[model samples]
Target chain A: AQSVAQPEDQVNVAEGNPLTVKCTYSVSGNPYLFWYVQYPNRGLQFLLKYITGDNLVKGSYGFEAEFNKSQTSFHLKKPSALVSDSALYFCAVRDIYRGSTLGRLYFGRGTQLTVWP
Target chain B: DVKVTQSSRYLVKRTGEKVFLECVQDMDHENMFWYRQDPGLGLRLIYFSYDVKMKEKGDIPEGYSVSREKKERFSLILESASTNQTSMYLCASSPPGYNSYEQYFGPGTRLTVT
Candidate 1:
């Protein structure tokens, strides 16, 4: 079974300051990690994913994440925060071998990021 | 562009009534999924269908059923609607492959069962 953990329920940052949202995972095999964002009364939108390759992966809306194998973490980062970026973020993981099984997704509780002006 | 459409943005129903939530995908993807989202729980899968007329149970399948009469349409049925079933229901679809292709989602239907 695979599982994802989002350590923070809410994160606050001033506009123009760097921001980070932490995520960790526990899976038997190599993990297919993803980040999604949801706006108020809207569906979730894909942000980025980390399958393999460079540790650092760039995503939409000026967001990026660094995959740390040793730490078992995939933390989302932004060079500078924007007030418009405030929304709910989710971290999800899937086992490499399990394709699209019922247990494919192990999502975090979600993190509400608020970028203040 | 891949487009997934949900039949309703909001629905209200009474207990014991049968409810059907419809979803359609235009990408001709082989896989369609139903998920329910609640506060603090993120998203939990209710059911999935890989092909037409082929359905599989998901993490939380109790009190829920699915039908895939066509490749592009997947419907979720609540046998007997209950207040516990009230939540935001999301429909998603993805291509059949090994690579990590992101699942396209519908706007979601917020069902309120009373």
Candidate 2:
């Protein structure tokens, strides 16, 4: 079974400060990781994904995540936080070797980020 | 750009009533999925179809059914709406292949069962 966990329910940061949302996962085989953002009353928007590449992958809205295989973690990061960046963040994981699963992703409960201006 | 659209942004239905939620994707994706989102549970997959007339149950598929008559459209049906069925329903699509992992999502429909 593939599963994702977001340890923090909420993260608060000041404007211009760096922000980080933590995520970790468990899978039977190699994992395909993803991050998505959801604003108020809106659907989720893809932020980035880590299939097989460098440890760090850049994504939209000046966000990036580092894939740490040893830690089984993929944490979202931004150099500077913005008030508009406040939203709910979700981490998802899929086992690439599980063809029987049909590309299904297991998602975390979500983390609510608040950036103060 | 991939665009996934849902039929309704908000809907209210009564208990024991049959409900239909529609979704359409314009990117000609081979896989379509239906999921229900809750405040603390994130998203749970309900059903998915890999091709026309082919559907598979996901993590949660009880009391729900799906239809995919065409390549671009998928519909979710609630056999009998119940209060516990009220939640934000989301639809997603992705192309078939091992390399294609990200799934594009619709804006979502907020369904209320009274």
Candidate 3:
């Protein structure tokens, strides 16, 4: 089974400060990690993903995530937080179920991020 | 731009009534998925279709079914709407092969079963 975990239910950060939403995962094989953000009453937007590349992956809206294989973690990061950055964040792992050709994803419980101005 | 649109943004249905949630993607993606989003539960997949007339059950498929008669459209059906079936449903589509790593999502449909 492939699963991702967002340890923090809520994270608060002041504007202009660096912010991180922690995520850890457990997978049977090499992990394909992804980050998505969802605003109220909206669908999730893809932020970034880590497949087979550098440790750090940059994404939309000045966001990035570091993939650490040893720690089994893929934490979303931003150098500066903005009030508009407040949303629910989710970390997911790509999963190809046995006997299935379609690729699916398993997401975390989600982390609510509040960027205070 | 890859656009995935749902039939409705909000719906209210009575218990025992049948419900249909439609999704269409302009990207011609080979894989389309249906997921129900609840508070604290994240997103649970209900079903997915990788090709026309071919469907696969997902992590949570009880009380729900899917249809894929065409390549660009997928539909989720609730046999009998229940109060517990009320949720925000999301639709997503992804290209095949290597690009399948990422999925494009619809704005979502909020369904209320009373």
Provide the TM-score of chain A alone for each candidate, in the order shown.
0.93, 0.94, 0.97
> Which structure among the candidates has the greatest lDDT?
3
Better of 2 and 3 by TM-score: 3
lDDT of 1 by residue, B14-109 (tens): 999999999999999888889999998989989988889998888899999999999999999999999999999999988876763688889999
Q: Where is the poorest 10-residue window by lDDT in model 3 chain A?
A: A94-103
Q: What's the distance in Å from true for residue B84, model 3?
A: 0.1
Cα distance off (Å), candidate 1, residue B36: 0.6
| Candidate number of the best DockQ | 3
Candidate 2 structure lDDT:
0.93
In model 3, how large is the Cα lDDT of residue B50?
85
Q: What are the per-residue Cα lDDT tens digits for candidate 1 across A62-98?
A: 9999999999999999999999999999999965324
DockQ of each: 0.54, 0.65, 0.74
lDDT by residue (tens digit), candidate 2, A1-117 = 889999999999999999999999998777799999999888889999998879999999999999999999999999999999999999999754235545877889999999998
Q: Write the per-residue lDDT of candidate 3 for residues A25-55, one digit (tens) a residue.
A: 9998889999999999999999999998899
Ordered list by DockQ, greatest first: 3, 2, 1
Candidate 3 residue-wise lDDT at B76: 98
What's the fnat for candidate 3, on a 0 to 1 scale? Answer: 0.67
Candidates' C-alpha lDDT: 0.90, 0.93, 0.94
